[model samples]
Target: MANSTLLSRTRAERAAAERTTGEPVGQGRRIGSHLVLVLLAIYFVVPLWWLAVASTKTNAGLFGGAPLWFGSDFALGDNIATLFSYQGGIYWIWFRNSFVYAIAGGVGATVLSVLAGYGLAKYRFRGRGAFFALLLGSVMVPMTALVIPTFVLLSGMGLLNTMWAVILPSLLSPVGVYLVRVYAQDAVPEEVLDAGRVDGAGEIRLFFQVVLPLLRPAIVTVLLLTTVATWNNFFLPLAVLRDPNLLPVTVGVYNWQALSNAGAGGEQVWNLIVTGSFISVVPLVAAFLSLQKYWQGGLSLGSVR
Candidate 1:
């Protein structure tokens, strides 16, 4: 009886100690997480903060004053008016061009990726593994390396300086294909495909109606990724398009900033350049924030399933 009582007391003491230790570990984890998140928040917000402050200043203030703080004179109104007036308001044209390329290319890439990935994942056919291997290899290749070759090809087709030059190449995204493939493979089960086959539904109908619905998260992820990538595609557009009218936001902003640096051409329009860059980012930011929830859910679903 004495031994039994001592054993119970020892067990109780051990349990109490474990509880005390676990509580600190949990608290420490939470604290660490919060600290990391705070750091990340600062990392993202700081540049935007600087951009906001810089956009308010004149060329003299931009060159002469502090980077992170506001200048003595706020030229936001004049900056916007000048930005809109530059080159007969061609900045608006660039903005529209970017939107068109991003949205249209994103949609095309997503559709192709979904179909290609779904076909690869759901079907067993000849050259399937080989095709997947080729796709994986393609994903490993850098897009920068393809620019010269893409330019040559587009030149051969006489498509350079046209929207098609950028749009056609942007449509092919190995990363999107890979993501969709992984998502479709897991989110869409073999049993489900078998059931669809057993039903009177055709493959296209089954994919469009059933499998596609299940892969909504992945679709959104691919769309967002493609849109952002296409929106930010500077090198491709730069290499292919010599026409200012065909220039996207990045190229257009670069030209404006370059011209602004040429002090001989009256006074440099620094405020417009800064404000234009700031405004150019608004759509991208909106798109990112809007799709972030879907993006997170996509990654979670892909990982879990």
Candidate 2:
């Protein structure tokens, strides 16, 4: 009886200790995961932080001071003024061109992706498997390899050095098409389509009224992806465009960087380059922040379904 009592007391004490301390293995794993996430966050954020600090400094301060921290002389406003006034305000032109290309290309790509993806997911057509395979293969091919061929094709068509040169190529997004196809397959049920058909809805009517609303998340994702891709495209624009006015902010910044790199005779416009780069990132950041909720909702909806 005394031995039994002692065993019960020992078991109770162990349970109490566990309740107080929690499971060590699971707790350690959680801590390790949090540490990894914190490290990754710092890795991504440090560059942006450095860029912001650098943008606030003058050309001399950029070389003299700590790269990650702000300098004594805050020249962000002067830098902005110079950026706008430099070479007859060419930066604004580049900014405008970027907006045009991103919007037009993004919308066009999203539309095509939605249409193509929806068709591939829902319809039973001849050569569908072959078309999808080609798309997957295209996705695997490096975009840089195609830049030369695209340049030649654009040159032959007399589209080189024009906005269409960039925008046209940006519209052909194989990844976006694949993303939309996968999303549509699971998101839009055949039962729903049949129900719409039972209501005498035509294909176009069903697409607009029934199918589109369900694919909102995929559309937003594709739009953001294509827009960012076109905005950041440097090699394509550099290869095709020679005119300063036709260049996007990305290429415009590169031109400034090249001039800054040239020894002695070339102008040192490092301040403008850093400041311009910082400014250029704002629109994309805004776009992601604004559209985040839509995609998040889509994820939740998919999970629930």
Each prediction's whole-model lDDT (CA) = 0.83, 0.86
lDDT of 2 by residue, 42-153 (tens): 9999999999999999999999978998899999999999988999889989999999999999999999999999999999999999999999899889999999999999
- In the range 209-250, model 1's lDDT, one tens digit per residue, is 899898887798788888889999999999999999999999
**Model 1: CA > 4 A from native:** 1-40, 63-66, 262-264, 299-305
Indicate the worst ten consecutive residues by lDDT in candidate 2.
Answer: 296-305
Residue 84 C-alpha lDDT in model 2? 83
Which one wins on lDDT?
2
- Tell how far residue 99 is off in model 2, in angstroms: 1.3
What TM value does model 1 have?
0.84
Residue runs of model 2 more than 4 Å from their true location after superposition:
1-36, 264-266, 295-305
